[model samples]
Target: MYLWIITGVVLIVSFIFNKDKTIQGLKKAWKQLYGIGSLLVLVLICVAIALNFINEDLITQTLSGGNRYIGFLSAVVIGSIAMMPGFIAFPLAGILRQNNVPFMVVSAFTTTLMMVGILTFPFEKKYLGFKVALIRNFICFTICIVVALVTGLIYREIF
Candidate 1:
């Protein structure tokens, strides 16, 4: 890929100019990668477990044709809690959509999937204080529901 090529060139240039610094940088990067990689693995494992437990039938049965408010609330809560990467979440969302999941539900889930992170609350609270973090997440959560509902309505009216 282009990015791989670019990274290789940059790394070669770095090695040419300063081997020691480049080695130190690589070591630091490796440590960071190790930590992040472990976290990613854990997240993926949890996602897989959840996906196995929550099948298409379950989603269709629960999230479909129910009270819109209930569907929206369920989507928001599930989205806020799921901490998978967008790469994983997007495809999972597509599967939900294909299984006749409401676009509104998908929108809410995907939006909050990116915006809210219950798992990351501790980190947010530590840096931003609990009140600010809570307020921000609450606002984002409200926006996700509004956006999903509006989008669903528009889609229905237009098409």
Candidate 2:
């Protein structure tokens, strides 16, 4: 892919200029990757299993029915409740889309998955204060809905 080529070029250039720094950076990156890799694999495995149990028709009916609004709202609620990093959320979004979920619902789900933190609210409130945490979550939730609507319009999912 283009991104891989670009990254390889940049990495080679970095190594040519400063091998030590490049090696250090790679080590740090590897450490982070190693830490997250296991969790990522587990999550993917769980998703695969869940997908087998879930009916694609049900998802299409519930999440792809843009005009209903129920599907959109359901996605938002599910997204808000679930917490995961962007790396994980993206692949999940792709799976959802492949399963016939519309762009609107996938965007809403991924946006809220990354932005809204209902499960982490207590920790956020402790560090950021209840008011700030509450406001941030509210704003993020509203923004995700707008994003979903715009995506729906773009995809002609909403009539």
Candidate 3:
């Protein structure tokens, strides 16, 4: 609601200054949206299916969710390997936590989901050779573990 209102105000202001430029900008934005609409739809569908099919209780029961180290490691592996957009991934992490999953596990999952990109390795490799891509992802994965551990420990202590 606020976004629409703010966007309306911006569009009105832009049109007042220069209608043609504003129109052209809107057209470009629309074109870009159209291009990614299909990809967005597919990603959302996959996310929904994954969340529904993968039982939260099973993960909690099997992955030693009560054991911080095991949960952390499991989170790191799952998050690193899963190919999810940040927009969707964060919400999923929250859902896991709400389902009584451990804080450390959710933290690790969220951290690696943002920092490491196992699925995007091909794209990264195309830009920066395979070696660099491999190294970068490895380093990022390690750093994510550290960050998640610290965040989880502090969060657990405070709350």
Highest TM-score among the candidates is held by which one?
Answer: 1
**lDDT per residue, candidate 3, 86-154, as tens digits?**
777666667777767677678787778788876566656766799999999999988887887788778
Worst 10 residues of 2 by lDDT: 51-60
Q: Which candidate is the best by lDDT?
A: 1
**Candidate RMSDs in order:** 4.3, 7.1, 5.4
Error of 1 at 83 (Å): 4.3
Q: 1-159, model 2: which lDDT tens digit per residue?
A: 999999999999999999999999999999878866765676666656655644344444566654546767878877786666677667766877876777888888778878897766765676679999999999999999999899999999988
lDDT of 3 at 126: 61
Quickly count the clashes in candidate 3.
Answer: 0
lDDT (0 to 1) per candidate: 0.78, 0.77, 0.73
Collision count of model 2: 0
The C-alpha TM-scores of every prediction are 0.64, 0.58, 0.62
lDDT ranking of the models: 1, 2, 3
